[model samples]
Target: MQHTDKSLQRKVNFLLYYAVISTSIFLVFILSSFVGKDKNLTADEITVKRITVVGEDNLPRMVLSNETRQHSGRMEGKEFPKRERPAGIIFFTNKGDECGGIVAATTAKDGSVNHGMSFTMDNYHDDQVIQLLNDETYENGKAEVSRGLMFNEYPVGSNLNDRMAKTEELKKIADPKEREAKIGELWDKEGAKRRMFIGRNVNADAGVFLYDAKGKPKMKIYVDKAGNPKIEVRDSTGKYKNIIQQ
Candidate 1:
């Protein structure tokens, strides 16, 4: 009976041990789950090279980065290789395509200044269609400033990859005449031109300029530095048909 008592006591101890281990394990799992569910990280100041905001599918939607660490842009699910860019945030579409963002900064060195900013929004699968831009450049002892709103054209159904391929093909052309002809055919498209410009031109004229689909100037209403206001209109052939000055 003493031996029996000992055996039963050993069984009880074993059961107690099992129960303790199982309870500890369950409690640890519950605590870890609560810890994992905590998604917020609060801090007063955080410094990093880049911060990427992702969507539910774990794809980056926006990235704030320094110039060196900026995200290489994407097009139609393909990412371009890394390139030098100004420090800024890069906006991406939901499907991971690059849409647009602010890429503006100023750099001055050795008596030369390149100061400007371009706030641009791009087309669905193409380049910038509209922008607010400011450019100030002082190089080789000459200074120029251009600030304005501009609208560009992107041919419907044009693809960035197609343009890139065209550029590559142009590079392989051996004949200058043939290359120029190819350029005219490739670049001179109905919807691939600067359609409107409203700002200070390089010639220091502050005004609005409209262009046709072929990028020929169709109209201009601007004022010179001396405050002379002028309006000019062109016919279908882009010849000046009327000019009014005040």
Candidate 2:
């Protein structure tokens, strides 16, 4: 009877040990499931709270509390520091995929926005007007503006004098009927096409003019608010072709 009692107690101990081990395994699986659920946080979702600007002759300055930089992942602002003559008024914007706009204000000796021109660049192809001064005082400044076009080189067309000379030469060679036909063919071959103009803006308030080989005005483009020139074209019948903005 004592031997039987020892065997039953052994079975009870074995069952208790198995119960504890099973409970531990179940608890571990439950805990792992709770920790592994998706939290839904990404790197792009994090915001940049501040931006640090660095420039010449100045310590690094941090501009805080700007929400514009947070959304676009960049920062831009203006700083006017009191210093000696010919000091530059620097405008800065931080780096990102689509960075913020730049507000470059060039000041004269009196610290005013020089000649009412603000230099800026919004995109890659936009024309940026940069002032060329004789000295740092910004005296005797000249304005030069440029427009961007697609082609690498500008095409050539007939000049007014050359067209007139061609007409005269054709009259001498053929009858009026044949001369008119030849002139039409020449116009179709050379006169109907347009030329491309590409250049960078050198100064503000400067206008870029596009002319045909005949020295006639083809288009007049001006700089926009973002410091980029807007090109306006017209058809022969005076209808608008399209506005090209850089």
Candidate 3:
């Protein structure tokens, strides 16, 4: 009977131990589940969103809808000089949420000009759409050409001025035939590097003149409509290479 009693006690102790271990494991599982729930709840509560200003209504004049993906506008006028003809109206939208108005301008009617010159004014109130009329002047109430020339946001010399300078330089060089040969050689060897550097340092539409070996003007290199340098070779047979923008 004592042996039986001892055996029964041992079984009870073993059962108790198993129950305690199972309880502990269940409690740990419960705690982990609670933590997971809290983490999921926290994640669900937080959210982020991006707001983009889009459409033709968002851009500035001289900028085309097809040319730029987001935010663009255009305006045109014939009142300005032929070379300074307004290309179209442009609208610059305020990217910041703070109180600000859209700046607008118009290009000269004649598209022959290198750059359009016109200006307009705009006002800014909190979360409001600012509209500018094409006929209006800049905030300072002056014409675009009158204010100053800006390449991107920075000021630079005018296209007319640049052209005149290049022309003067060409005149200084004497032999036209030799100049052509030199320009051809340069284009074949170092054209890409030189053009890439110039495009970076100056306005997208800036013009550059190339002279031949004899120091005479051979061809004119200027930024094309797409803002890439368009190099014209004097000899139709001359080979030219395209520079890929990295």
Q: Tell me, by TM-score, which candidate is best.
A: 1
What is the C-alpha local distance difference test score of each model?
0.84, 0.44, 0.39
- Give me candidate 1's TM-score against the actual structure: 0.77
Task: Give the least accurate 10-residue stretch of model 3, judged by summed lDDT.
Answer: 146-155
Q: Work out the TM-score per prediction.
A: 0.77, 0.19, 0.17
- Winning model by lDDT: 1
Cα lDDT of model 2 by residue, 14-35, tens digit = 9999999999999998777666
lDDT of 1 by residue, 39-148 (tens): 46678999999999988777779999888898888888788888888888888888888888888788989889999888888888887888999999998989798999
Candidate 1, 151: how far from true, in Å? 0.5
Task: Name the regions of candidate 2 deviating beyond 4 angstroms.
Answer: 1-174, 190-192, 198-220, 223-230, 233-237, 241-246
Ranking by TM-score: 1, 2, 3
Q: Between 1 and 3, whose TM-score is larger?
A: 1
- lDDT, candidate 2, equals 0.44
Model 3 misses residue 124 by how many Å?
Answer: 21
Q: For model 3, how does the per-residue alpha-carbon lDDT over 193-244 read when each residue is reduced to its tens digit?
A: 1111122112324455455533344565666547665666666466544443
Look at candidate 2 and give me any clashing residue pairs.
none
